[model samples]
Target: MTQQELQQLVEQISLEYFKRPFRHRVVINHRFKTTGGRYHLADHHLEFNPAFLTAELRTDLIGIVKHELTHYHLHLLHRGYRHQDRDFKVLLQQVGGSRFALDVGNRRPQAKKFHYICTNCGQQYHRVKRIDTRRYRCGVCSGILKITTKM
Candidate 1:
């Protein structure tokens, strides 16, 4: 959707749900990598991820809008606006907004993991934590395991 469309939608949702008119700006931000939307405290503008613009995720888009609106409205009124604030949580739930942003687009790669191998069967295993080689055996072959790489 165009920037104008996004602005209209944000304004509509704010008025309908929060019963408050959004006096600032709303813009689509393609650079948002992990979050669905963000509310700027400095300027009171709302930035939304463009990935949620698909027709299939219209509800998700609405939820994101409400989430950001919660921040916008609360901050404007000098109420609790941070995520940990009771007022923010209450308002977010009242609006039925998403508790978390939808994951869209490419995410950062996972941290390096431990790579182990079964000495007898050559089967490999990836684990987030280091395991005791003497106690833990290969699930497939029940063979002794050895760490091959820290990654």
Candidate 2:
């Protein structure tokens, strides 16, 4: 959705659920990586990940909005706005906000450690976790495997 639509949605949700007006800007921040949304304490602006607007991630979008709104409203009211606070937890539950942002697993394979290269055949291997190069060898040519990169 556009920034204007997101702002309207946040205003609507704020009034509907919290019974308070959201007098702050809501922007779609495409650069947001892991977290679904973030409420800026200094400026009181709410930022949402653009991925949340997609059809497959609508529920996550709502949940994240609620989560950020929880912080927004609480901080505005000078109440406990932190995740560890009771007020934050209670309000989040009442609003059906996600306790933690949903982990939509990394779209691309993350760089792995312990890259192994075959000595004889020049084969390459990547592993998510560390592997013992000494115990493993190249299947193609039974070549000794060497560590290429740590990550």
Best by lDDT: 1
* Candidate 2, residue 88: lDDT: 98
Extract clashing residue pairs from model 1. none
lDDT of 2 by residue, 51-130 (tens): 77877888888888999999999998999999999999999999999988777763566767668889888999988888
Model 2 local distance difference test score: 0.87
Task: Give per-residue CA lDDT, model 1, range 10-118, as digits (tens).
Answer: 8999899989999998888888889899888999999988889888888999999999999999998999999999999999999999989778755877665999999
lDDT score, candidate 2, position 13: 88
- Alpha-carbon local distance difference test for all models: 0.90, 0.87
Candidate 1, lDDT over the whole model? 0.90
Q: Which stretches of candidate 1 lie over 4 Å from their true place?
A: 108-114, 118-123, 127-151
What TM-score fits each model?
Answer: 0.75, 0.74
